[model samples]
Target: MQQGGNPNDIFIKINALLEEAKPRFSEECCIYKVPNNIRKLNEDAYTPQVVSIGPFHHANQNLQKMEDQKRLYCRQFIERSETKNLESLVSCVQEMEEEVRSCYSDDIKLSKEEHVMLILVDSCFILEFLLRFYFLVTRGDDSILLPEQLLVHIRNDLLLVENQVPFFVLDKLYYLSFPSTLNGEDLHNHPPLLSLTCYILPGFMISEDNFVLLSVSSDVDFGRIAHFVDLTRKLLLKSSKLFQLSTSDCSREAQVTHIYSASELNELGVKFEVNKNTECLLDITLSGHTLRIPFIRVHDWTELVLRNLLAFEQCHCIHESYLTDYTLFLDFLINTDKDVDLLIKKGIIENWLGDSNAVAKMFNGLAANTVTPDFNVQYSNIFKDLNAFCAHPWNKKVATLKRDYCNTPWKTVASIAAIFLLILTIIQTIFSILQVVH
Candidate 1:
């Protein structure tokens, strides 16, 4: 019996362990912990700074200071909600606890009561925050977002892949909070949550001219959206006919072998121009010798937003990583500050960070830990065409000649003078030969 180790006891222990080891992932799972390989490059970009929304960062002591704020928002949300009582909201979340748990990639360790409470408070906070933001923008009302720095931090935190609740949770809470809006009386005053979300994240719009705030319709299915990150991705790709049409044909096994930098392309007679035809930043196009790219603003929080989006695509999107592909394309075109400067001068990039080197570094660092599966279809044709154009003997010779003799006005004049002198000397020699023959 060796230390009273019984067969039945061992069997029971093994059975319990097996139960715990069952798969936690579901088809609904979208919210993910940013992979360490990606997060290690810049932890602050992926980690929530002032607030934690979901289960992944719920236990972080650094984020606990925001707990009071969360409760306060939740209270305000309830006070203004149509239900006007806490119990209804609590019940709604409690009913969806299992489904909500399935939405997260990691197994939530909180007990049912704790999990429900977490979801309730976080969801209400987000809903209320968006509502206030909407009123502030549309009616000039003051809001907690009045503090510019805090607003920036909150925007960054809310967009982080790790710091998100399911969008459906927010949607359900939103409708429940404003039941009368469904009947159309207060519909104008209370826009859908998605529209308010767009207002708060204006940077993702790329161009205001083409960014349409989502309206609730049969075409707009809120159920499919996993979280704010997914919504942002959708918003980005919504207007890109190129992406919409080509995504299905894109091959995941292909890779982009090579492409020249912006300066290199310029040297090869390739012109870069600001694309005015489309608002989607991903709708980059190449025609003849010109490359047209939509304008993108780079600011303090740009990297933070992009890194999170990149991480989300890496973790979830299997077939179409549009954002990832776009990022890799930019990385291929920008290798140094010179490339950034070239793009800035061409109006492709609005560098608000004010440092070209920093912008270059940001683009270069974006694709460090990510994989571009559909790179071949996404921009492989452009690379192929550019390489073919650049490789032509005539093109290279012309480029070389320009570099050697015509790069400056003084050099151009000197070369022209030398050529004229050579022609004159050749004519003189021919005349001298004729004289000798005579």
Candidate 2:
């Protein structure tokens, strides 16, 4: 059989073709490993080629595969391109290159021609993985990504600032030698790294008592701040789901905890941003797990919060009370206007007025009784470490009752029944004594 001709030799054929293409674009070509199940794999593999070869290689094996699978539905474009439309694509590439230069500083800039080339290169390099991952993870159904064209356009952009070597080159060189922020903590020398790291282990307040230390460093940025809010929302949702799952199989507590840990990693996108710090550490007392995020560099605040909202909807522990409160808090944070009436009118925020009112009445009765309640005891132990909440004397009382109320509802019921029975027996005995005397 010819080297790559057999039906069973698909991978081999692709590899052979790559070997042949390597010398043609020797400086740019690099071998890559990609997922077969994800459709973006082929496009991703071919993106680099676009930068070097122009649009002429549209028939390259990967693009052909995409067309064959009807993923892109580009038969008409291919047919038209074969005859009439080369200049439009070139013009599109030119326009895309101009758009990229806007991202960089304007003071010490190159001429327009040089500018477009460098920006295209930078765009291609930075966006290769990001665009592919987006398509693979978010919207891979009816495929509309033009991976090869995008790569060429981005490559042209990068080449616009031709004098400046590609960023990844410098990033690789200085990254390892740079001072260690945390043994495994440093994300990037760039601005976004610090913020990205924050999302990996965003801090959270547990129950009404514990404050889990999600990270050690505290120089957080907007990205991390956004991530923290998003993570809190997702965790609460997950916690609610765990609660429901617990009602069915109490034995699944460990499983529930594991699911929380795993979901936290998967939903947070920290693994992609900060892969080194994603591992979980044991929390023996709580029978739970913890992951630490080091916040050093940060940006992209709004993105983080929006991401959190999406994750919150996916979490299982979402409770009605918590969701209602969370929704209000998120609205308060994101809404620009300071009008409470407007917020209520928009129907975006549900008033917690009713719950707060009930709580006030219960506390008022406690205050009137003038009784001193216990000052130490944790209900769920989840929030026990949160010194901010737990240090208050009033909080201690609430914590104590909450624990008792949650842990032994059946026992409390049984005690009330016993007391009623004893009272009834005494009344009967008194009646019998009266009869005997008569």
Candidate 3:
């Protein structure tokens, strides 16, 4: 205004600035598209085959087959929940449409009406599936999702990072469908969402007894769960409290360049054993010249679950690299069939994949697609301690002798007796030579 004599010019400039409106969200901020590079490795793991939940592949030809079933579930949910106002659900989402859209990294091109319907249908289907699927698996009841194989595919689909409805939206719709009630029993008890989720993805879970004894509650609001992928990750983390990053200000990694494979470590006289501790699965010990690892079951679905976790770590959870670090550690430990064999013999790895080579290939391939951080990031102390232990000559000699002479109980006994007899014979010969010389 001070420089320009005409107000029209200034108004024009302002209008130009106002034309380009800023968006509410950015990609990689919350939920994100699976990077093409990672997806290319195992496209099936990233894609939804049986059903699609979110806007990504909700309209695909293969996924469209589930739409009728989804509608059926929705109708059943409507009956079970006895929801009074369906419009309320749409209005609730419409109020925060921009915010809700922001949760997804990609632009959803659907109209407001279509978007709202997607939410209503997807959320309703998820709720019903969780409830019905849990009952079927646990109780062996009515055949809601027949052929059981379909159920398996659908279960995998639910865990896909691409197929997700926002947790907040799900939460609102959930409570709307099932209004909270205050009874004599604790309100902070088991939430159906947690139970259903636990049932769907049992492979990724560590707890053998269906996370039923989990300490989480419905009353506690888990802050801003991005979607089901994030929820699964959170559950994994909740079960393993020791995985929380240490409050150390500085990043201290170890001097380890590379961790030897399990078999290689064994040759260096490192003993292999399974850790019976019920803490973090990555809670490994290298003391007493023994390397103890927690039991990790290896199955065909193992790679799928791990790949999803790897993708999740890559796209989200950037700060805490627990899953990334764990997969990388396993990759380093299992470079070949020999390594898998050693782990199997030690009871550390339960190979349900029929052969040791498959497990080895799985780990090797997992390491291929993953982002390996600095060697000493989280396990700096453990690796440093391991390096010191492995570098010791006494440990090497002991390990060599144990491997060569004491491989089995019989071998150890025979070796001990032979050594003892040899020593006695030497002594007698020395005494005889001394008498003869005298």
Candidate with best TM-score: 1
**C-alpha positional error of residue 435 in candidate 2 after TM-score superposition, expressed in Å:** 5.0
Give all candidate RMSDs, comma-separated. Answer: 3.2, 21.2, 5.7
Q: Which candidate wins on lDDT?
A: 1
Error of 3 at 178 (Å): 1.2
Tens digits of per-residue lDDT for model 3, 1-438: 456557888899899998876664565256667888888878887888788887989779987878887887876767766365767767887876766777787879999888888878888888887777666533343334776777888878887777887777777776676664212232333144555566676463556352555434323244456777776666566555345333452243533356778876887777888987654465666667687787888766777777777787787765565676667778778988989998998889888888988898888877565555444344656555566777889978877888889889999999999999999999999999999999
TM-score of each model, paired residue for residue: 0.90, 0.22, 0.83
- Please provide, for model 2 over 1-438, each residue's C-alpha lDDT reduced to its tens digit, 9 standing for 90 to 100: 656556668888888988876232122211111122321312332233222222223235643433333312222222222233434433444665443333222222466765544333332323322323333433354333445455333333222111122233222222222325234443332222222222223222223111223222222222222222333443433333222222442221211000112122222221212112222111112222222221111111222322223222222123322332222222222222233222233332234443323322322221121111211111123323322333557755654554555336786676668778999999999999999999
A best-first ranking of the candidates according to their TM-score comes to 1, 3, 2
| TM-score-better candidate, 1 vs 2 | 1
Candidate 1: tens digits of C-alpha lDDT, residues 1-438: 557789899999999998888676688789988888888999889888899998999999998888998888889889888779788888999999999999888878899999999999999999888888778643233335767787778878899999999988998888888988756668677876767776656464534434443343224568888888887777676667576633575455566667889988888788999998878888788998899998898988889988888888888984578788888889989999999999999989999998999999999999897876556375777777888889999889888888899888999999999999999999999999999999
Ranking by lDDT: 1, 3, 2
Query: Clashing residue pairs, candidate 3?
Result: 254-376
